[model samples]
Every structure is written in structure tokens, then in C-alpha cells.
Target: MPLLRTNTADKFIVDRRKTHRNSDVSRAVKHTRDRLSQRSGSPAFDRELLKLHARAIVTGASAIPLLVLVIAAAGLLGGMGGTILSWALVTVTCYTGIALFARSIDKADTARIELAATKRNFLILHSLSGLCWAYLASLGCGECQVEQFPVIKAVVLLLAMAATAIIASSLRGALVATFAAPVIVYGVVGARYWMPVEATMIGLLAISLPFFAYVAGHLNRSALMLLSFRREKDGLIAELETAKSMSDEARRRAEEANLAKSRFLASMSHELRTPLNAILGFSEVMSNEVLGQIQNTTYKEYARDIHDSGRHLLDLINEILDLSRIEAGRYQLNEEPVSLLDVVEECCHLMELRARNKDLRIVQQFEASLPRLFADERAIRQIALNLISNAVKFTPAGGEIVVKVGWTAGGGQYVSVADDGPGIPPDEIPVVLSAFGQGSIAIKSAEQGTGLGLPIVQGLLAMHGGEFQLNSKLREGTEAIAIFPRGRVMEDMPALPTLPLRAVASGGRRR
Candidate 1:
């Protein structure tokens, strides 16, 4: 419930509630639909579509048997490879029927392989019927004992051939799974020779009827199941997409509100600063005797209160402005040639009054040979001032604060600000660098701040393609090392005009 963060928090809560409601409703609907689909034995597939496939399987099966028998009869008459050729044709017909039936049955939620086998099984009965025919027709009058083959001498031989075909079919596919081997074994032995050609062939077909029926029924059921689920799947996907669009719109509105919040902070802060500075400035002048003081201690006390209140308000305003500038992406730095020595001297000078007030000693060691860093002078000063101020604010009275400037091993210069402050633990380092947070040491130190200074320094450093690091211990000291690339800070040198003191003080950021 922080002021700036309140709107985002509210939106997040609302979004969560909406998401939960949608999820609950979707779950309930899916559960009901799924239960209904499972309980109803109603065909999920289109009746017309499944009927089309059943028609094809039954029709082709009935037709192919006759053609294969004729072909096998031709083999018996004069063709040597007639049986094999007929078998191949029957196999080819089975495969073709499976391929065509697969497309039609597959429109439903049925298992593809099982349906394919069902179609093939429907066709396989054709070959068996043909085998029965060949054996029966070969028993022509029993006069021609073709090749001295006894089984081929009578119409009664149909049973033996039929049993052989059934056993062969049991070699693979669902037939092996559905029919018992012992049944084929017993049928071939005792019951095979007990019938004439016509009776034996017809009986063989009757025995295969049950297996054929099971395959057909399963194929129909699978196709219907697939179709039913297909409809449900499409419906669920559409619902999900609609929900996603709603969630995206809500997110977009939340972002717009956040942007508006950033704008409000920016405008209000700038306006507040104009009057805040006047209050602090005139208070300073009166306290310094630049304005004649009234001869009363009460008046002096009131002036002190006014000065303190104004300064505190100014600090709050500055934090808001810097944070808002970063949020709005308008925090541009002024690039100029800056001497490292000068930057260190200026930051130290600014922090000296604050340091002396707390009896803290800030020791600076400036390198004379430090090169001119090409970057924003204002940013460098801000970074240095914030770091030095942090160092002074955290270091205990009578402890040392060491500020050192030199070139790093790389071309970039290194400015290290160290202090014998109550230091940050390794785990707490990242927490301090986070926006709106401070180090454990800083929080417990003599001065309090808005927890913005380090983040501002880090942001300004990133603008220059520079880097910074911190090294410290729990009780020893903390060191902030800043590295700026060695080049002209301003590569695109726009002609800069010399500014008067009042304009510089008014416009350029002082802290």
C-alpha cells in the first residue's frame, strides 16, 4: 500500500480474482462434459461416415472372395503359381481396403492401428472363402484324383483346407489373439473329414463369422469415439484463447495506469521543488546573517524549524524526481570532459559540511596523472557525491573514510571510496542496490535517506557504458569502485555555451 505502488497492487489483486473465477468455471464445465461423454454409449462419430467405411469393408470382402476363388480354380486347372498369385492379390486387396477404410474410420477418435487391422480382418475372410472354394471345386466328381492328392480328390476335402487356412491366419494379427490354437488343431483332426464339399465350405465360413463380427464392432466404436472428442477438443481450445485475450487486455490497462502514475509523480515533484528551494535558500540566507535577524530567540527557533522542514521536503522531492525520471526514461546525462581530480575534489567539498557535522573525517588521495574521462560531469559528480555521502554517513565518528582515484588495469579509470563503516554482509549487498532499499549499515547509521542514492548512481553509470563494484566486510569498511571507459565523455560534441552562475545553479542538479 505504498503511494506510488498502490495502483499496481490493486490491479494485480483484481487480475488474480478474475483468473481464479475463470479457472473454476472452466474446470466445472470440462468435468461435466467429460462425465457426460464417458457415460453415454451414443456414437461420437457421424453415423453416415462410419456406415460408409462399414459398407466398403463388407462390400469389398464379399466381392473379393469370389474373384480369388475363380483365380484359385484357374490354378487348379492349368496355372502353376495360381494359388500364390491369388494369395498375393488377396493380400493386396486387404492392404488397399485397410488404407481406404482407415481414412473414413479415422475421422473419429479411434485407434488407427486397431481400425486398420479390423478392415484387414474383414478382407482376410475373402482369402479363406477362396481357399474353401478351391478345395471344394477340386473334388469334381472324385474322378480326377489330381496328382494323386487324396485331400484334393473329394468335395469333403474342404474341411482340411479350411482348418489349414484358419491355423495360418492365427500366425499374426488379432486373429491369433482372438482364436485358440487348440480349436484349429482339433478341427483339422476329428471334424475335418466328416462333411461334403458344399457343406464343409459353408461350415468353414460359419465358424469365421464370430471373429469377423467382433472386429467390425470395435472399428465402429473407435471411429465414433474419435469424432466425439474432436468436437470437444476444438471447443476447449477456443475457450482458452478467449480467456487469454481477456487476460492480455487487463494487463495492458494495468500498464497504462502505471505509466500515468509515473507521470503524476514527475509533474508534482518538479512543481514542489521550485517552492521548496526558495524556502531552504532564504532560510539559509537568514541563518547566515545575509538577512538581518529579529532580536528574539523564538523567532530564531521558528526559522530553524522552517529551514529543517524545507530541507527534508527538498530531499523527498529530489528522490521522487530522480525515481520518476528513471521510470519515464528521461534521465539524460550531460556529457563533458571531466577531470577525475576535479570530480573527487568537488564531491568531497560538498560532503565536507555534512561529514564535519557528525565528526567524520573524509580522507581523499587524488592521482595527479589521471586522464580526462569522457562522460557527463553532472553524473560523475552525482555518483561521487552519493558514494562519498554514503561513506561519510555510514562510517562511525573518529573512524577513517578513504577516497582514492587511479587508473584500473584496463583503460578505464577507477575511483574507490572506502570507509570504516558498519559494513554490509555479502548476502545483503544486492538488497542495498535494489530501488527503495538501503544497506543494513546505512539504515543503522547516523543519517537517514530515501534509499535512492545508490540506484541513481548505478543508473548513471550504465548510461556511460561504465561499471561499478562494491567490496566490504561486516565490521571493517566498504569500498565502491567505479570504472569509466577512457575516452571523451561527449563523442558528439555539440557546441556548448558558457553558462552564468545563477543559471547553472538553478538548472543543473546540485546533489
Candidate 2:
């Protein structure tokens, strides 16, 4: 017993060839999609946020040192020059250290940085800077006759808080870490004086710190949202590139496989046909007793069977080669002006004998005086023959097959073959049109076919810039139409002008 029947073996081979490659591609796409769908707080996203924070700090590094210098210059007018200058040097040095640390972080690879440890170090540095500012806020100039000195100090702190909020927005809690101590210290020193102006300045400092921190939190959320968008965009681009590469590979492989198949068929055609021709000729001669008389009746029947089967196999091979050449774009058309009505009529006549043998009626309906079509005569004949032959093969005894040749609605020529037979199911039309694909009716029927007829017809029509349509319904009938475009319809040319005999003679004498 065979493990696989012929058709089953063919199907198994095709599926096995396709399954592994298709599954691998689908798995890769699914993995990419899942990886990209991770939430915003994933480690990758956190690293991106840290990198943004480091960059922001480096960008605004000079602002703090400049502000300290300006404050120190203002303090000289209040006769507290030495105290302010000394404080300025300390503040500037602290800010320079913080800036250097931030720059180092920005230049280093994000993958090497530990997020928790980096955040902790940044907060510690910011708290130290806060202490330096707190000391400045506590200083006073009572003997210098600068009446608005307390207000000036409060205004400077407010400016510093606002700047910190903007610069450190990407890192959560950074603004609060840098300004919380300063606000507390300023409020404490003002409480000692207990004057109305001092109380007001302290109240403003306390209120402004939380306000700036709230703004910084909002800015941090915005930064995270922006980073998420950037990450998603990059993921989408990567997915597209992967899909494109897979598509290109599949197409290239398909082209190579097609080329290999074409070459095998081209080389094997001659080899196969040589033996088939000898078999067919010998079988026919033996069946007819051309050389000698046969003794047994069984021998004669076997010879006839060999001839018939050989003929069928040869036809199948020819059909396969024709379809293959058409698919590979190697089938060149021998084009000419051919009559649509005449070509279709000839095809109907050729199939009429088979129709008669099956007890089926073939009716021809051709339009009168149809224009000639500029097309490959052989291709057009094959189209008509395929359709008509299918009709004859499938139509039951006493059924009718109509072969119509006429004008299409698009001002083009068309050949339509319709049969009153057990029709194809609508869903199976596509299968019937595919190469080596047979419909259920064709498979179950006694008629033998290689299932290359309709596909070859379609490919040939396509080469001629035409279209083939199959319309069928179960238990109703089937109709196959081959339509030639209006461009292929040859128009009548104007008559050439006739010259008088005298003018012709004068031209000949001049020559």
C-alpha cells in the first residue's frame, strides 16, 4: 500500500515547503509588536528620561554661576562686599561641580547607568546646592542703609526657584530638592525680626517653592510622554523595515524558483517528447496493424489504449509548457489582423465533433460584419477552444452549449462560451482558473483533464492586454468570456487617392 496517493503527495510537498518560512516570519512580527507595546515606566523608558534630565542640566549649567556673580555685584553697593564676594565664590564652585557631574552623565552610555543610584546622587548634589543658597538667604545688611535689602533677597530666591523648575523638569522631585532648604532657612531668619515686611517675604518664599515644584512635576510628565512617542515611532519604523525585508526575500525566492522550474521544463520538453513520439507512432501502427496483422483481439485493444493514453499525456505536457512560458513572460505573440468572428467560429467547429460524440448541442451566435482584431491568432484560438471544450466536456447528454462572438460593452470584441450543465459552485471559480487546479465537478466527472486549460487561456489573454471572466452558479450553468480591449480592434482605413493614367505616365517619363 502506498503511504500517499498522487494528489495527496503533491499537496503535502507544497505545504511542507511553505509552512516553516511563513511561521518564522509571523513569529518575528508578533515578537516585535509585543516588545514595542511595553508601558512607559519600563527600564528602557526610565533610561531615556534620565538621559533627558542629564542633558537639561548640562544646558543650563552657566545660568546659576552668572546669577551668583550679579547678586555679588549688587551686594557691593550695600557695603557688604567682602561677605557677598566670599559667598559668591563658594556658590559658583558648587554650581561648577554639579555642572561637571551632569556633563559626565550626559556623555556616558545610558545602559551603563543604574537608574536608582543615579537619581540618588543627583538629589544629594541638588540638596548641597540648596544649603549654599540657604546661607545666602540668611545674610542681612542692616547697617548699610539698603532699606529694600530683605525684598531684594526674597526676589533673588524666587528667580532661582523658577530657573531650577524649568531646567530640572525632566527629573521628578529635582526642583523641590534644590529649593526646599532655602525656603525654610529664609522663613526662619525673617521670623526673628517679626516685622510685617519680613513676615510677607517669608510667606512668599514658602508659597513659591511648592508652586515651582508643581510646575516641575507637570513638565516631567510631559517629558515622559514625549519620550514614549519617540520610542513608539522608532519601533514602528523598525517593524516596517523588517516587513519590507521579508517581503523582498520572499519575492526574490519566488522569482528564483520560477526560473528554475522554467529551465527544468525547457530542458525536459525535448527529452520527454522524443520518447513520447516514438511510443505514439508505434502504438498507432500496432493498433492499425500497419506492418502486420494482429492475432489476438486483446492485443489490438491494448495497442489502442496505449495510443490514446500517449496522446493525452502529450497534450498535458504541451499545455503545461505553454502555461509555463506564458507565466515566465517568454511566450512571444505572433500578432496579425485576425477576424474575431472567424477565429471563434473555427474553434466551435473543431469542438463540434466532441460535442456530437457526447450527444451535446453546440450553438453559435456570432454578430454580422464584426471588425478584425489585432492580436495573436494562436492565443485567440486557444482562448476560444478552451472555453468551448470545457462546455462540451461538462455538458450532459441533450444539453446545449452556446458559443457567442460579438462586441463588448467597452467597444471591443468578445468571445463567450456558456453551457447548460451541472454548473460550478461560485466559490470554486478561482480554483478553476488557477494552474493545475480543478473544480469539484471536473474532478468527479468522467472527463480527464490536466486542469491547465483555463489558466493558459487567462495568461494568453493577459499577454494580449485582454481579460477573461468566468461566471457560474450551481445547477444553473457556467459562462466564460474572453474580452479584447478596444485598442486591439482594427479600424477601417481611408481609401487611397487614385491618379489619372496621363499623370502616371508623365511621372514615369520624368523619372
Which model scores highest in lDDT?
2
Q: List the candidate 1 regions with Cα displacement exceeding 4 Å.
A: 1-104, 108-254, 281-292, 486-511
For each candidate, what TM-score against the reference? 0.57, 0.86
Model 2 has an lDDT value of 0.84
Cα lDDT tens digits for candidate 1, 1-511: 0011101111011334454456776685777487437522333332333344544444444443444455456545644454545554754465455445545553544433354355365446444434433433333323333442323322223332333233223122333322333234334532445455534544554465455445544554555565557657766776678668988999899899988887787677778888888988887777666767568877677777899989977886786677667655788877667787888888898888888887888888876666577778888888898889888878888777888887666556767888988888876776677676777667766576777787777777767877777777898888887777665332335678999999888887764
- Per-residue lDDT tens digits of candidate 2, residues 1-511? 0011111122111434454557866886687667666655788877788889889889999898899999999888768969999999988888888888888889989899888888888888888889889999899896688877888899999999999999989888888888888888888888898789988999888888888889988888898878767867887788789889988999999989988998899889999999999999999999999999999989999999999999999999999899878877889999999998888888888988998899988888888788789999988998888888888878889899988888877788888888988888855666777778888977887398888898888888789898777777788888888888999999999899999999999999999
Flag clash pairs in model 2.
none
Name the regions of candidate 2 deviating beyond 4 angstroms.
1-45, 70-80, 141-151, 192-201, 230-256, 506-511
Worst 10 residues of 1 by lDDT: 1-10
lDDT scores in order: 0.60, 0.84
